[model samples]
Target: MRTRHVHPRPADPTSTSRRTMFVVLLLCVALGSVLAPGLEPANAIGRTSPAATLPSQDDGSSITWSVRPSPTDADPERPNFGYDIAPGVTVTDSIRVRNYSEETLRLDLYASDAITTSTGALDLLPAGEEPTGVGAWISLDSSELAIAPLEFVDVDFTLTVPADAEPGDHTGGIVTSHRTPGVDDGGDTVILDRRLGNRVHVRVDGPLRPALQISDAEVSYTGSFNPVGTGSMHVTYTVTNTGNVRLGAEQTVTTNGRLFFPGRTVTPEPMGELLPGNSLTFDVDVGEVWPIGRTTATIELTPIPTRDGDVFDADTPVESASVTAPTMPWTLLASLAVLVGVAVLWRRHRRRRERREAALVDAAVREALADTPNASDGSDGSDGSEQDGSEHDEPQHENGDRDRAPDGTGAGVGGAHRSGERRGPPAPRGNEQ
Candidate 1:
């Protein structure tokens, strides 16, 4: 067996070496691909991650990049532009640019020019571009940037919103340029082609803010201070949202030279929010003023947003309503009028009693005078008395002496019946008529 195998082994040819060489060549190619500096990862489908992980363009050999934003279209649910600010507010945000390439690349950050490629977003038909005097152009930023390959770089910015600024929509962008440094002048070297990207939409915003301002500095009420120097009144304040976006607000109400409602320390401080073009209302209480007089007052208003939202505000003074204090004159006058009426009535009652007593005295005097007239009729000359007698009395005749004698004892005793007569007092007679 050994002898037969030895003859076969001698015939070993170069074919085996040829096959080994081919296998070694294949292995070298595979290893070269794995170690290549320019090799890149495969691309993914769709926008599934926060920022698409892509290669950076250095010399434009095989680097890749994309222009991305949080949203590709204007979201009706969330508008692209707006601001929400309250008095004393500051807004802050962060921007991230992620590199997914195998090599380092330079990135230039700037304010994006308002533009899209001709085939990108040029609107037409019903969705055509609006007639804006402003055209879409590139914007430049003074910020600096350099990102390491496969690294995430973060940038931050802040917007200081004024308390008195009107709430509304504001739009802006952040652009990035991928190109070689010191090589941008007309392509001096074999530099990468100009690769530009942008965040087309950015908004400086706050929450829906609502504010309330009283036309009056303070409201009137049955406030503290028992027996207030002046009367009190209450105030109701209504706030209107005049901004294009919602606003979140907080507020405080106070009074100067006046007391708060209920008690000085009991003034209410309200906090809330309001939608855009909406209004809010509140009430305030103020104590009375001095002099029991009427007056007007103005209120100072300061409103601010709690979050990023739109709002409108004027730090100037705003007038509310006419204020009036209680007066003592009318009340005192009413009491005085009542007292005067009582006095007049008492005086009239006293005069009526006096007139009644005078009438009674006059009636008594007339009776006494009538009795004296009878006495005068009896005492006066007979003729005067008889003529002045009442109409009911009979007239005296010439036989008066005979009638008188008939009552006497001697002459006509037989003819005359016993009858008695009494003499009366004389009546008043005219003097030597």
Candidate 2:
């Protein structure tokens, strides 16, 4: 057997291990690139996330950055850019971005529309969503910029109001952001965007009709069984901004009825701000009220021009709404039921007493009738002694025959028999024949 000298094949280094190491190194580099940008202070981005004033400062280990509106901006102390503009007009403004950091910094500029959050606070539009309001009208001079350390740049922008813009307040913002490439430990790449913005408030001037309407008026009552106890009354109404200007309302709710004479007043929660065509519903609770019968609840609203600080005319009519609801008198109803029951029982007792008295009278009358003498019986109107004397005086006959007494009266048969028996010895001979 020619066993060829089997030269031991040097164990080839497993390619799997080398490949694993290479993948890990690549992942580490990518992760570092992704996370390195976040190492900076969050304040590097200004405080304009939600209606922040300008001159916002950010301090780093060896750097400071700031973003703000130019000094020439109106109402610099406020967080927003306020302007009274007319349709078909164009306005110009500027923003300043300063890099005090030791290293160069890059920034991206953008404009976005303002939107009201679910909690009623205002905020900038989300990324990737195109703006349709004032943001659509703004044009930035440059979208990208790079600044050397300790340097600053002013970016100019223009706002052109369309002729058909709605006559109301339009809000938007100018934003600056720094984006960096980042890779996570899982090897996923992402762009980290750190952004900040300054608010812009523009009012399109036109026919500013300030009007409010009250609608959907409702009244509810919670009753108590205690006649004198207090109950609860709730009144709800909706306040709609029916005009072109924003407004706040001073609301008063009044209830008048038997439960509350004169009237009961309730103050609802303050309606902070209402934009055009917006509506807010209010619920007013009035406790410790004695409600009875019908109650009329009225809501009155006094409009206050707050958005533009305009003076509301004193002659403006108050917006009012009313609703009526019937209240049940449980206590009164229970008392009436008790009274009715008592009346029915009393009536029944009276009837029973009358029936008993009538029955007794009938029994007494029957007894009297039974004891009365019969007038048809033949009897002389004389005492019993007279009748006996007449009968005894009548003569008796020897043959036991009695003569006819006057007035066609004769002794009863029994009396004749008794007289015959007492005359002994058959008429005693001398009285015969």
Q: Which candidate achieves the best lDDT against the true structure?
A: 2
Query: Which residue pairs in candidate 2 have backbone atoms (N, alpha carbon, C) closer than 3 angstroms, thus clashing?
Result: 34-182, 34-183
lDDT of each: 0.39, 0.66
The residue-by-residue lDDT of candidate 2 on 268-379, one tens digit each, is 7666666566677777887766656777788888888766568767786778888988766777788889999999999999999999999999999999999988876636
Candidate 1, residues 12-87, lDDT tens digits: the string is 2332245544544344334334432332211111212233222222222233333343222344223222334453
TM-score, cand. 1: 0.29
* Candidate number with greatest TM-score: 2
How well does candidate 2 score on lDDT at residue 222? 88
Off by over 4 Å in 1: 1-230, 241-278, 289-341, 371-433
RMSD, one per candidate, in order: 25.9, 17.3
Q: Which residue ranges in model 2 land beyond 4 Å of their true spot?
A: 1-70, 73-76, 94-130, 140-156, 172-198, 258-260, 342-390, 394-433
